[model samples]
Target: DEPLDDENLIDYGLDSVRMMGLAARWRKVHGDIDFVMLAKNPTIDAWWALLSRGVE
Candidate 1:
């Protein structure tokens, strides 16, 4: 929400609605994923890497 903020990308920090928004976006491109896994690993670098691998 602020300029040059590093917090947003690193932790995700997405609320229930916001996390759902991301889940929808990922689903559109890669298909459905369990939201619980995302909550367990909320970092973009970590989760995106996992998603890129189509989940392990």
Candidate 2:
């Protein structure tokens, strides 16, 4: 299910294990990332911001 950008992912059943796996997968391609930071916000928009931080 695609969640709205502003929606809280935890509300949609996003648990820590899933979050960790996502972080691990993303890290493999994006380099080191703050998993806690992504987990803290738990929103699609926030995640995009984190992922696109250094990209122009």
Candidate 3:
């Protein structure tokens, strides 16, 4: 699906399992991340912000 940055991921079929998998994959490289919070704010912009938080 072509998602906009502010689009709700749930509206496009992103479920708990997919979300968990995404978090787990990210965790492999980024260390501990708040998956719950990420799920709460399910948007591309929010995801990018969360994932890039501590990077230079």
Candidate 4:
């Protein structure tokens, strides 16, 4: 199973479809996460900080 805290960005080698899946999941929990910010910063640690702060 995947780590609860990681984005699996490398292990799975994401394409656009995988990216969209991730964004959809975040939308369910966060509701305001735009793909633009995620595209701008594509690291798990960075996203973790953003999620913790409830960023929009």
Measured by TM-score, the strongest candidate is 3
Q: Assess every candidate by TM-score.
A: 0.55, 0.80, 0.82, 0.59
- Which whole-number lDDT from 0 to 100 does residue 41 have in model 1? 59
Off-target runs (Cα >4 Å) in candidate 4 are 1-12, 54-56
Off by over 4 Å in 2: none
Best by lDDT: 2
TM-score of model number 3:
0.82
Model 4, residue pairs in steric clash:
none
The lDDT ranking, best first, is 2, 3, 4, 1
Q: Name the lDDT value of residue 5 in candidate 4.
A: 49
In terms of lDDT, the poorest run of 10 residues in model 1 is: 2-11
Give per-residue CA lDDT, model 1, range 3-22, as digits (tens). Answer: 13323443444676776677
lDDT score for residue 37 of model 3: 71
lDDT of residue 25 for candidate 1: 71
Report, for every candidate in turn, its global Cα lDDT versus the true structure.
0.60, 0.86, 0.85, 0.67
**lDDT at 28, model 4:** 77
Prediction 1 global C-alpha lDDT: 0.60
Residue-pair clashes per candidate, as listed?
0, 0, 0, 0
lDDT of 3 by residue, 6-44 (tens): 999989999988899898888877787657977889999
Badly placed stretches (over 4 Å) of model 1 are 1-13, 54-56
Candidates ranked, most accurate by TM-score first: 3, 2, 4, 1
